[model samples]
Target: MSAATLVGSEAPLAQTHDVALVDLDGVAYQGHLPIDHAASSLGAARDGGMRLVFVTNNASREPEDVAAQLSGLDIPTSPDEVMTAAQACAALLATRLEPGAKVLVVGGKGLVTAVERAGFVVVRSADDAPDAVAQGFSPDLGWGDLAEAAYAVAGGAWHVASNRDLSLPTARGFAPGNGSLVAAVVSATGVEPDSAGKPSPTMYRMAVDRLDARRPLVIGDRLDTDLAGARSGGYPGLHVLTGVSSARDAVLAPPGLRPSYLGADLRALLEPHPAPQRADGGWWRCGDRAARVVGDGLEVDRQGPQGIDVVRAACAAAWAAADAGSGPAPQGVADLSA
Candidate 1:
């Protein structure tokens, strides 16, 4: 079984976990701009002996491109150290089809290269009579590409999507990701493609195997995909507040989406995680803070310089309440931004 709630670590996570399957888009950089403290904290963790794998759901670019971008952002990554959903998706299709199978590619160079590397014949349209349609995210994709995918799927071709993430983080904001494109095909043909990206354990398992990591931790910003993938992959995950999900989201997450630890940013890797403990009056306490779910609300003890401990305690109390058949009041969680 997965850990029931947030877990404490005696040492920094970089020391505790042998490898980190780190998410790229939201956790590391938001649309090319690196998150604050990400590069330095990651460097510190690497210096402390933890191996890092850049596991990403974005299938728009190749691993080399991803590595270059990360290196440019001061993350100092290599192609071999990066894994893309396009690669995983191609590998998945390879298992389902024979070598040199005709696959209609619907993304960019990343997906095309991945399919080709998997020993498949990459085609462009449904007219190719492709055996499979490999769909991923690409900004240049248009109605013509989606139409071809729909036609292929409508003609009994197997549909494979890199991921099902509904949103992609960008410098401006969240944009429609691969999932949105997949949904269009699904809506047109009423055929849901098999997804091989996050929320599925395949990507995480692949990273674990490739890195030969005995103790792997998942680090991400989204609770629905990244954290959910960690739980399904049987790895502990840290939910950071750098991207999509909020602290209140953590407090309200169900078991499948709940994270093992929570932090404000990448710096969490260098600090010890304080476990929340049960205190008097049914409150959950962490560090110098305490919180308990009241009737449709939460009574939080606002101690500590930063309210991380209080946030931790609040999450614990909320989770405890949820496990017992009810969740903490929305009003209490409404402003849990810290």
Candidate 2:
């Protein structure tokens, strides 16, 4: 659907969607710690009859380990409720390579287990004469691992990467993720690996199939990964502010990256969404908030009862202005919280 045609619903989102495909890093936990309200809100959503599935691009940890982490955080989950990019990458590789084909693993035990489960033999070095190379993220990975992947790819082994997320959030701060490591191999071999994570539609499709969801909502913090993947997979997405992207980033998002719903956090699933309607005098109204385009600039005419409403109105107005080519690109949202 076009961004201009998007509208909010009077019914609570929890009642509308059968399942929620939730991203892990930014939405549920920011590294090793769980985000505020994440556990409770998700539990409430589950109580309200909405199923929750944790979808992560991080391929370093196995599904069972990820489930254990979430369970320890008070959000009980099973391995079946979690989907990783490594699983998706392995599935993709299985379709191209013969059963029991030797595949060089360039990442962690997670990727190795995934490839092996898909009936491929996992090898460590290019000297193994592997038929393909699969890479993911692992803290234990080093220059030696990248060199092996590069050699394999340079020698014409089909290469696959779990995801291309350049940076990962950690308790200390941002650190290089799988994408940065993948770039090392790319620079050495001058060949790009086929990605099987977010923005590829492969992972989303797998999640949908696994959940058997008739109507699923994609929830995440990153626009480039989660929202982009939802859009590519023809699913509705909700962008939450509890993680990476801010209100300013959401308002300025391009057509493909814009989310269908914007919320402060997962609590939005229980609340009725206020539609932004075009108002008199070229204004847009959402709940008690209003915004307007004034000669290549955006002006906030009224702040809503809640800060999120104001953000919603501003996003609608800015996206409308962008579609009509009547205003400059939305720089930021005034009076909106991050």
Candidate 3:
């Protein structure tokens, strides 16, 4: 469905969609920490007959490790239920390269495992006369690693990157992700690597195919990656506020970047979503709140306790204004507090 025709679900989203292609880091857990209500909400969705697939751009860990980590967080998961960018990268490589082709790896064990599983021989240095180069993210990556990848790519080896996420969230803070390291190789060889992750429809399409899901909902925290990927793959996206994106971001989203649904957290999956309707005097009403685009700003009129409904109405008003060529809504236009 097109962004303009996007509407809220009258039924619980968990009952409407057969599968959920969920982003791991921000929507489920942040770094090693479990997000509030994530596990319980996910479990409830599972009980409601929705299959959950954890998707990640992090190529440092194997599926088993990722599943184990989720289990540790009290969210029971299996390797088959997880899809990594490394797997997507390897799957793409398999279609281009011949069987048993040697590929120079520049990341961690996860990348190596994915390549090997795809019937490609994993090599280390450029001296191996590699058929291609594959890169991903790893905590132990060093300057020496980027040099080898650059050398291989410069020597005519095809290059493929697991993902292009610029920054990764960690317990300490944001750190350089695979995309940052991939930039180094690009600078050295003046060549770009093919990516097989989010924002590129490949990973989402792969997950949908593997799950055999007729109806899938992509749930994520990042608009650029997860939600953008969902739009590219023709799937509805549910944006969560527990991670990087805020209500302000959603209200200001441009076409093709807007999510079909918005959630404060995973628990929104269990609740029916009310559609925002146009009211008199340029006002948009959603549930207990009404918002209007006044000049270049938004004004929210709450009829009940302040909640996500206010954000929904504000987004409707802002998007409507933008579509009418009224320009972007003013920043800090909505009273976000409860």
Residue-level lDDT of model 1, residues 80-120, one tens digit each, is 99888998998899788999899999999998999999999
- Candidate 3 residue-wise lDDT, 141-234, digit = tens: 9999989999899999999999999998777777888999999999999998899888877878888999899999999998888888888888
What's the CA error at residue 45 for candidate 1, in Å?
A: 0.8
Over 4 Å off, model 3? 4-6, 302-304, 329-338
Off by over 4 Å in 1: 304-306
TM-score winner among the candidates? 1
lDDT of 3 at 2: 57
How far off is residue 30 in model 1, in Å?
Answer: 1.3
Global lDDT of each candidate: 0.90, 0.86, 0.88
What does candidate 2's lDDT look like per residue over 1-338, in tens digits?
54423468789899999999999988988888988888999999999899988999988789999999999998999999999999999999988998989999988888888999999999988998889999999999988989999999999999899999999888888899899999999999999889998877788889899879999999999998999998888899999998777887877777888899988988888888888999999888887888777877778865335488878888888888888877645544454673
Q: Given candidate 3, what's the lDDT at residue 166?
A: 90
Evaluated against the true structure, the overall lDDT of model 1 is 0.90
For candidate 1, the TM-score is 0.98
Q: Supply the global lDDT for candidate 2.
A: 0.86
Ranking by lDDT, best first? Answer: 1, 3, 2
TM-score of each: 0.98, 0.95, 0.95
